[model samples]
Target: MIDKVAWLHLHQGQVLSTRSRGKDRYYLPGGKREPGETDAQTLVREIEEELTVALDPASLAYAGTFEAPAHGHPAGVRVRMTCYWAPRYTGTVQPAAEIAEVAWLTYRHRPQVSAVDQSIFDWLHDQHLLAE
Candidate 1:
């Protein structure tokens, strides 16, 4: 299983998502942890690399975890995604590095995300954080 992390930034009932270069599906921001890095460190670095923003470690809060078959992987390959919400951050979020596009998505956009991200959308909708 591949372990990954994601950032959840919600605004006006929509969630921030990103599509990487050459990728067809949009995903929550953030990425895999580097060796010897903590989740907070991973999140801060990944968000900066992908979003051109600085994630406030103090604002990090555990959101939820979701797992599903890894997209574009062989059978039996799975990804475990641990998500966090950072309400306090600095700079304007813009696509950077490999991020091809940045979007604010509602629950109605579920089909455009990965399976693990779809689960996140479901949970967010159930929590009333995502507009129907």
Candidate 2:
């Protein structure tokens, strides 16, 4: 199993997503936590690295957690994604590091993301936080 953290940045009913270099699917802008890092710490670092933005730790709140079959992995390999929402941040958002593209995605884009991300889309849509 793999563990990962993600940031849920919503704007105008769309969620920010990123596509890594050489990858086909788009994903939320955060990554896995390093050893000894809390979820907020990991979120801030990963978001800065990937999106060139600093997520204010004080503005972080739990969104939800999801589990699904790991994309492009062997059967039974799973990934657990814990997500957070940040209401404030600094800097412009641009693709950085391994990110090749940044997109604002809605429920219609569900099939273009990974399994776990699809679940997030569902939740956001149900809550009317994501556009149809």
Candidate 3:
């Protein structure tokens, strides 16, 4: 299992997503966890590395966990995502290493996201947290 952490960053009520350099679909901003690192630690490090901003460890709120077959991986390969919502953050958002594009997508564009990201969109919509 690939344990990962992702952030649901709402900007002007819009959710931020990113497409990796070689990936075709957009995904929530995050990355795999390193050894000896907690979820929050992995989240902070990933967000900083990919978005060029430091995340407040205390501000991370556990959203939910999502499991899905790895998009481009062999059969039986799976990824476990620990999602988080951060209503408070410091610094500007910008694409960094390995990030191809950073976009703020709404509910209407949910189909364009990864399967796991679609689950997140549904959960956000159910919670009345999606922008549209």
Candidate 4:
């Protein structure tokens, strides 16, 4: 299983998502944790790297976890995504580094994201946190 951390930035009923340089599917803005790094640390770092915004470590809240088949990978490969809600951050958000596009995606855009992110969209929809 590939363990990863992601930021759940919901605003106006849409979530922040990113598409890598050559990828078609969008994903929540975060990445794998480094050695000995906490979830918040990983999230802060990943978000900063991908979104060019620094997440306030102290403002992160546990969102939820989801596991699903890793998209574009060999069959049977799975990914466990630990998600967080970052209420505060510094700087502006933009597509940075390997990111090619940044978008605000709604639940209706589920089909355009990875499996793990689809699960997040489903959950958010069920909770009415995501707009139709």
Candidate 5:
């Protein structure tokens, strides 16, 4: 299955994350795409809905895509995560809607994230963007 996600970097060397409502682990601040939505559309909409920030369409960069076993899904099911990196942004971030808590995460605390998010953390670390 396809899952569209976004990775927002803060000026403090931390990445934005959300504790999904009722979930134990934290995740990147994004969600699945709705019908008739393009990847960019989904990313922009999801981030706005979850973070209450406006994403500049031109600033969104395609980082990379990752795949892993879907969380809370039947065994053998996988999720293909299309992740993007937005190095610049506008507006303050806040937890909205289904998001219970919002925080910035550093590489030292990467293990606290979900499996999919761990993959993202590794990628960012490899790119030398994550703080050691």
Candidate 6:
């Protein structure tokens, strides 16, 4: 399994998502953990790199983890996504680094995300956390 961390920034019932350069699928904005890095460390760094925002590490909250067949990968490969919610952040969010675009996606846009992200959308929808 490919382990990764993701940030969930929900506002007005929409989640912040990003599309990497040359990627067709949008995803929750975060990335894999570097050596010796905690989830919070990885989350803060990833979000900063991908979304041009500074996530408050002290306020990071564990959301949930979703696993599914990896998008744009071999069939047998899978991704285990550990998600978190950052209640506070600084700076305006914009596409940065390898990110090609940024969007506020709702449950209706589920199909545009990766499989693991779709599962995250489903959970959010089931909890009524994601909607138009």
Local accuracy of candidate 3 as per-residue lDDT tens digits, 50-124:
999988888889989998876777888888889987767788899999998999988998978887888888888
Off by over 4 Å in 2: none
Question: Candidate 1, residues 71-129: lDDT per residue as tens digits?
Answer: 87899999899999999999999999999999999999999999899999999999999
Clashing pairs in 3: none
Cα RMSD, each candidate: 0.6, 0.6, 1.3, 0.6, 1.5, 0.8
The 10-residue segment of model 4 with minimum total lDDT is 48-57
- What's the TM for model 2? 0.98
- TM-score-better candidate, 1 vs 6: 1
Clashes of each: 0, 0, 0, 0, 0, 0
Q: What C-alpha root-mean-square deviation, in Å, does candidate 1 show against the real structure?
A: 0.6
For model 5, the stretches where C-alpha displacement exceeds 4 angstroms are: none
Of 2 and 3, the candidate ahead on lDDT is 2
Give stretches of model 6 more than 4 Å off: none
- Considering every candidate listed, which one attains the maximal lDDT? 1
TM-score of 4: 0.98
Provide the lowest-lDDT 10-residue window in model 2.
24-33
Give TM per candidate.
0.98, 0.98, 0.93, 0.98, 0.90, 0.97
Instruction: Give a tens-digit lDDT track for model 6, residues 1-132.
Output: 899999988999999999999999999999999999999999999998888889998899899999999999988999999999999999999998999999999998998999999999999999899995
List the pairs of residues colliding in candidate 6. Answer: none
TM-score, candidate number 5: 0.90
lDDT of 2 by residue, 1-132 (tens): 788999999999999999999998988888888999999888999999999999889999998999999898899999999999998999999999999999999999999999999999999999999999
